[model samples]
Target: MNFINGPCGYFNMIVITSRSSSIPIVFRRQLSALTTLPLTLSQTNKNGQKHDPPSKINSPPPLGRLRASVVSPESTHFVDSYLTHSFFSDELKISAKNGFLSRGRQLHAHIVKLGYYNVLALQNQLLHVYVKCKVYYDACRLFDEMLVRNVVTWNTLICGAAHCGRSFKSNLNLGFCYFKRMLSEMVGPDCVTFTSLLHTCIELYDIEIGRQVHCFIMKFGLCRDCFVSSALVDLYAKFGLVGDARRIFDNILDRDLVSWNVMVYCYALNCLVRDAFGLFNLMRLEGIKEDDFTCTNLLNSAAIYGSCELGRQIHGLVIKLSFDLDVAVSSALVDMYAKNELIVDARKTFDGMLSRNVISWTTMIVGYGRVGDGKEAIKLIREMFRGDTGPDELTLASVLRSCGNSSSITEISQVHAYAMKDGFDAILSTANSLINAYSKSGNITMALDCFSSIANPDLVSWTSMIGAYAFNGLSIEGIELFERMLAYNMMPDPVAFLGVLSACSHGGLVYEGLHYFSLMTKIYHITPTIEHYTCLIDLLGRAGLLDEAFNLLTSMPVEPGPDVLGAFIGACKVHGNAGLAKWAAEKLFALEPSNPVNYTLMSNIYASEGCWLDVARIRKMMRDRCIYKVPGCSWTEIAGEVHTFVSSDKSHPRASEVYALSELLVRSMEEEDYVPNEDFTFDHV
Candidate 1:
């Protein structure tokens, strides 16, 4: 029998043919010399018969490298044994790389028989192989039994434990314990040790521990270590301490490409666009070429700053550097264009990408949703499903948002079913978005069901459910839900408070609205924003307190914005306070001169008060300014199709039928003594 040596170890005995009989002799001799095993090339086949080797077998070189030694026999023997162990280690690594765990175990057994099991270097190699195979338990067991250990041994286990992605808290403690033990053993932790520990802190967001590690590095005068310093920069930057990150970066005596890239990323993450660009320019001046990381970070900053001009420049640079093909850089570019309201450009970038991941798809969906293009966004969702990139929580949430904007109830229900089927209904973000969608679609019962489905609703969930109640005119229930939220020890954020205030305003609970407004600022320490003030003004105005609402608007710390002024004008029209109506209208017109609603509001108020001359003057001003009232439009969904009708519109395909039916209904109502209110009709001169 002839045996061929596999890459990892020697094969067992097999029959050798006459043509290949010579190769086994030399190969066996080399194996025997290396492993100290006697050569036996004969074996029985599975059928209990001897098998002959192939007729045309090629002879290969020896499996292991052996060095000549001029030392004593004992020294030469040790060198050869070490070289044999190294050969086995390399073979085991190759097995691990190929994911042949069974072959790796076999190689491990061979190393033990060669009397190198206790060798520190070989043990570390085995540990690495086990880690590569994701058999961390076995690696830990081996680590516990090793009588001899070195820094490399501990570093391997520490780094592996930190990156194993299992029982993070336990592994983190284990890694830290190993570091502490290394210190007690006087093994002297190196740059690799600190970098691993710092990374763990980064993942855990344990800033205090990371700070201590930074101090330790400084104490040991290892501050100049580029890798350690770069990790320190990352640690600080992640914690939002960009100043400290920059300080550490500046202190690095010898900065590498990683250090520069990290600092640039740090600046970008903090939204310091000018500083990031300045440092990037400095990096270029230093002759350091830009890579994908640099471009991605700069593009993210451009997105945050909403600078499409800067983003275009970066996009040009990306194409110049041929980095546009990089998925990460391309995703960043898509996000930048989407945020800047350049949806066409965003679509162009997304379409040009050769490959896209989940994030890339989600970004485009969100872009379309933001522009209220519900049809386009839903189409993309279907395309995503066809392409096998199933929608995740973010994708579903964005699609729900689009459905809400378009008031597409059918689409909302379909997406909600998909969420339940995909088990994403349990996620808080999806649940909140579902509540918002159902509420906007005028299905309060379904919205309530979605709210009740959450296992442990967070603040956002509470706020969304409360808003659903408020929006659907269930003000009492909305207030009760807010109280329930407080009873559960849930702190109300600005949005939650806004929901309750809106509920109070809608319910006409002036005292409750005023009380909560005070409580929000005094008890919760939440600062009132323009939305809150607008709600308050509307509440006062709705209760026939136009003067009080106007006074509140004037007393606001900040200048009354368009929404606030618009709310005040609406109150004037409601209460027939034409004097205050004119004042609010002037401000609204100045703020939004082209908005026809302001002119319409003023003309309606004058006509209501029988001021025909004032109404004519307002009409003339609108005509001179070329502003026309935007016709009021209402839509209804029938059989999953939306039918929209503008006031006095005659453009529908079945307009004559609709108008005839309307005329018939009105005549029937008049015959039944239904009196039409003529007070709201505008009289033309």
Candidate 2:
């Protein structure tokens, strides 16, 4: 056998033999050649006898015989002694890197048997191996057993505790405990220690503790450390303190790539789009190469602002930089396009990804949902299951939202059943979406049932259930639910107030509506938005309090939006107040000049007041502007299929039959002395 040195001091041995040799002869020759090597002379056999070097054998044996002989106790001992101490440490590190925990443990035992376990350097190496293998308990045990500890040893254990993949809160607490213990023992922490603690704080979202760590870093004069500074930036950014993060980032005199990336991400996370882009430009100008992290952050910022143009530009840059194939970058791109309503581009990016995780799949499904393509979103869900990637809670929530938007009750029920079977129905977000889906589908009972099923509902659950009741005309139930939410110590957000206000409006509870509106602002400290004002105006108008509604609209602290004015105008038309309607319509026209609904509403009001000239003038204005009213349409679901009918529509496949049945029903009604109201007939128009 011939031995050759390999990388990292491991040996690579090769053996050659005559092709015609018998197995027995090859085995004998291999044993003879092994005995002649310098390594075998120091070997101790199982019987505690030493093997003498053979004199007669000079040639190497065949490979098979050599391998078999090396497994013997004496030969194994010989090889262990042949390796140097540094070489042995390297081998252990290789084993750890390969995730061979069993091999690492065996090597550790060998080190102990060789009486090298007391060596501080070797023990630290073993500790690192244990940490890398995620055998944190073993690492801690070894750490406790060490008679002498150094800064590296303490840092290793502390950092390992932080990254042990246990519950984040528990792991972070453990890390802090170890840190305090290190300090008590007079082991001053270095930059690495502070960096690890900052990371733990980031994960725990304990900004107070993070601030303490920051103060310590500054006291120790370690604030200039690039890695430590970047971690601080990340910590504050995650806590939504972007201004503080920027201050730290700006103080870094020797900023590294990580510092630049983190500051850009901080700005992006806080939705400071212009600032993020500005920092990105500055980074490029400073000649820092942008990585996948940079592109992902910028793409996410673009998604928030719905800036498709900026997103497309970034997409081009991503492709130019060859980052389009990266999973994180690609996922962000898909999300950006989806949020901007560019479903086609989003799908294209999704399909082009070489690999897909749950996030990528969820992003595409959400994009389809946002565009009101519920069918496509559900199709992706099935495809995801078939591909062996089971949908998670987020995936289910997004699909539920899509179904709600499209009013696809059948799909929603299917998804709900799947969620129940898969045990995701109990997840808070998924359950909240279920309430929304049921409510948007007009299934108020199911919405309430879902709400009741929640053992401890969150604010979203209460808001969604309340909205369902309000939208379905169960204003009393909605109002009661709001009170129940308050009783549970859950403060109502603007959305919750909106639901209750809408409910009061629909139920003709004008005083209740006004009271909630005031309560939302004064007690809850939530400023009333245009949506709230619209609800209040609609409530008063429905109750024939048009003047009060108008006064409230005009007295809004902020300028009323088109929705508020439109609601007021709608109220005037409902009460047949031509002067108020004309005044509100002029405001609506100025705000939304191209809206055909406003023109039609004004015309209807004038016609109801027998003002033919004003009605003709409004019609002429609509024609001159080429504005046309959207045809009123309604749909009904039957046998899991939706059938739609538009006003004066004769294009249905069964239109003639439907018309004949309608005529027969009218004739029968006349025979029964049924009186028909003619106020809304074409003759009035």
Candidate 3:
């Protein structure tokens, strides 16, 4: 098609003079061989009648397409000739569709083969192209080839290094060196240059350098610049300076949506859910339009809050805004709702998705698991495998955790086999999850076996396996794991110490627990956390060392937190130490006034001691405080539906049938003189 300016010659074409502007003269000669039709044209009708060309059409007067033609990949000569221009580079822009990288790379290779040497521009683009291809070596070679490198040249190298995950010390230094040179040589770095530099700083955890960069930009009057402002927000956010990041973001002269989203994401990632939501509300009040990224951030924040109500509200807004169809946003919504135990909402969202990625499928599966739908979790995995999608390390790990509840050792092994085949067995998170799964599944040995297979376990991995042993009632094994961890010279974090202390508590190894507790502080300088104290109380309580437990709580340097107080109260209950239990209850109530569990535990303690008046008083306190014990519910997924079972709730779809069967089973057990264990489980009457 011949494309030209309008008759008035007042319009410029969007990009090309014609779609075939990149075609060169020599490339057109070969097209004649492909088709038998002679090159020809038709005349346009002007005003009334069609005008005839003089027997023949004059040759086109341009270097573009001489004749219409089709070329295949095998026609290397044609491709080389055709690619000697900047056509595909423009199309690689963000406005183009998803496969720009693929098409752009093919054209780039062809362009290089044509040997049209503009050494400077070519070297600059070559560095970027090689980086895009993840060919870091070639990128470096091309970067070094430039006799006179410009600012773009240096920025390209740094960006390429950062993009390719070449966090190698030298590469990281070179990126910084280039940034420094830009300042020293006075190349006048732009917004892109500073943002890239900040990313490198964050990756390297050079918070000091990041701060300096921020100040530098501010002094130069670039603080109001959106790109600089956003980069600073992200950098400070990453380094745990949420307040500073938020301040910089707030001070931006013109806060665009991207700026808002970046700041909001920073808040959410730092676990400041309230602040995130508050900022989101601010955005809405300011009449800022929310997009998929915005929805994703808000929903993700709500999910982290573990607030079902808030998550549902965001999900509703997404539907209202028609952003529910966005795969990333919808997947985030699913995760949020799932974690909130709104399985129905999560499943509905997942089902409504027009397309789903592996992350989407896995998020739903994890949501099911969080709601205790182990069967549904496994079912989803099976379905994913049956369909086109397959499980990643995270999916495998989550499903293994689902199997933990059933103690499905056989199924766990099967998953392990699958992991081995898919080469996902090497990921650290997967390994840790598998260890926890095995431990919970009543195979402490297998859990240990799994831990041993991780060639080198980080602190988290080691702590996980050690905690696994302690969790599964094998305190001796847990202690041994801790000892082994110490032998490897892996500095145990506070969590690791808690696991070891709890192990000692379980094994009645009071002396060992005390020794490690001391070593944890004196040798490792690790401060004892509330959880560590809880483990000590549990240890002493379980071993009937009631007075020592009371003494431990009283001797704490700081005021006891809820978990610590709760632990002491639980121990007092176990040992029938009424006075200590009363003190523990009072501390717990004062610390966590809204905790129904504390009130209920106090009432139960009074009831056990047959103190009727005290029980009455406890109940009165509960009533005055408006505290009521929420009935616990458990859900299991089967046949694509989550079956929720709750005490005193007759709303399960199979409630009538399940209740009748439960009654029958209870009757049979009663006839056999079986007594219900009301102490451990409050769910059943």
RMSD of each candidate relative to the true structure: 9.7, 9.8, 9.6
Sorted by lDDT (best first), the order is 1, 2, 3
| Candidate number with the higher lDDT (1 or 2) | 1
Across 580-665, the per-residue lDDT of candidate 3 in tens digits comes to 89977887888778767777888888777889799888777877885466766676545434456767778877678888998999
Write model 1 residue lDDT over 444-514, tens digit each, in one string. Answer: 99999998989999899999989999998899999999999999999888999999999998988899999
What lDDT score belongs to each candidate, Candidate 1 first? 0.81, 0.80, 0.73
- Candidate 3 displacement at residue 598 in angstroms: 4.6
lDDT of model 2 at residue 236?
93
Q: Encode model 2's per-residue lDDT on 1-685: one tens digit a residue.
A: 3332322332323323334432111132233232222333333334334344444233333323333443443443233223334444666677767877887787687566444555666677788888778787898899999988888998887787677654546656878998989989989999889988988887776899999999999999988888889989999999999989989998999998889999999988899999999999999999999999999999999998789988999999999999988999999999999898888989988999999999999999989988888889999999998996789999999999998887788888999999999989888899999999999889988888888889889899999899999988999999999999999999899999999999999999988998998899889899888888889988998898998988997898988888887777777777778788778888888888877777877787777789999999988887776456667677766666656798778988989998999999999999999998643433221
User: What would the TM-scores of all predictions be?
Assistant: 0.71, 0.72, 0.72
User: What ranges in model 3 sit over 4 Å off?
Assistant: 1-118, 129-145, 164-174, 219-221, 239-243, 267-288, 305-317, 542-548, 573-576, 589-685
